[model samples]
Target: MLEVDGLTCRFGTKAAVDNASFSIEPGRFVGVIGRSGAGKSTLLRMINRLETPTSGRILFEGVDVTALQGRDLRRWRARSAMIFQQFNLVGRLDVLTNVLMGRLAGVPLWRSLIQHWPQNDKAVAISALEQFDMMPMAAQRADQLSGGQQQRVAIARAIVQQPDIILADEPIASLDPRNTRIVMDALLRINKHFGITVICNLHSLDLARTYCDRLIGMSAGRIVFDGAPAALTDSIARELYDLEAGEVMDDAPDFVPGELTPAFGNVAA
Candidate 1:
């Protein structure tokens, strides 16, 4: 389990994430939803230790994640992989090499510098690519792939890391509708197949309801709602997004409750 107690992040006088607290069980798929500037990204960054918390404790199992430093911190990062909004792959590198980069923490600096990857690691990388139906593009440059394809490559990289949890920050924010479904399907497959805990930040309410087992809603910098997807009514969504009834009904079309249309096809598991 993961425990976050009074987690807070302040930017001078402004609180980016205010006294947020939550707990996640193993293998659960969680979605964090809120409007822009709701501090959702900051909260995830704190959990990943990419951004230091102003105060509070984050504990995984029995380990104090907040106190880890140096090698300990590096190990923690290796265990918890992060997928960003912009697919953070090396544009010039081939898809396979980019996936192999996940093993850099375990590889010696000299070997990595010389591009001398172990055969086992290479096999693992190829397996991940095949799982995502990205094996055909293994030799292609990351920059050449479509947005959805790049995101899948990014996911393949995360899988090769063999992480216990995957933290995705607005992963589908920039994709087209079809690509959005494809990306979310890939994430859903990873969670179920590997039993890896997934904590994703999403802007789409329908996607969150369709994919996540639980939802955490934030407003300003505070967590205002936490419950199963069905429990989040339109009223609660309005409150989370600070939308008036008229705005919710007319202005914010995406806020209305609806089913997420199924993807054209599932990526290979």
Candidate 2:
């Protein structure tokens, strides 16, 4: 569904993303893993057009995303949602209202200006909240929710956008272990049930292996590994992280997703 070719982003003289190239198949849950400043986030941002590439081409369903400008760029952004490490919710607004903001691309200007969402848009937002068992808290202030809940709200907001793909940049880096499990499960559910292709930048190899079907590893601003979870052997893992084999395999968390909170089955139905 998306292809990035010879992508490069330089800040002054230093390259943040140096000639990185990859492709994402439709509905694939892909994880980009790397250390700090490895260019994982920059790669996703360039694909989403949040950062302009110094030189390269990004194609979404064969559309030249790098060439998009004005309304065209706005349309592309609307179709490709971005979730951040910090839940980017308006702390003062009601949760449902924040979710409704996703419809800004499709809603008329007058309604958006007045913050008056149409009934259909309201229904969509409500349904999205329900997926995460958050319908009851629709009217609560965003700042009042827990970090996990806030992250779920952010996911709902992304869902309400009706995006085909979600680019999550370290979406769980700020959460506790329990909240990390919840957020990761929610993202997996979205990918499995809703068929939204997810490209997540994960710090934990265990989380990436548990949730992503494919793993793309980066080091020094270039792809070092790309393959299935099973293919990410000890040697490759060490190489990807620039560590010895003994130092790399001992840190993965062992969380099982046997019972999904809010019940992914019910959400799908």
lDDT of 2 at 216: 94
Q: Best candidate per TM-score, number? A: 2
Give lDDT tens digits, candidate 1, residues 1-269.
98999999999999999999999999999999888888999988888899999999999998999999988898788788999999999999999999999988888889888889999999999999987789999999999999999998998999998999899999998898767777787888888878999999988777788789999998889999999999999888877777533342342124222223342234332
What global local distance difference test value does model 2 have? Answer: 0.87
lDDT of 2 by residue, 1-269 (tens): 79989999999998989998888899999999877788999998998899999999999999999999988898888889999999899999999999998898898899987888899999999999998889999999999999999999999999999999999999998898778878888888888888999999987787788889999999888888899989998678877877533433444456665345554443344
Number of clashing residue pairs, candidate 1:
0
Give the count of colliding residue pairs in each prediction.
Answer: 0, 0
Model 2 quality (TM-score): 0.94
Candidate 1 Cα RMSD (Å): 3.4
Assess each prediction's global lDDT (C-alpha) against the native: 0.86, 0.87
- RMSD to truth, every model: 3.4, 2.0
Worst 10 residues of 2 by lDDT: 244-253
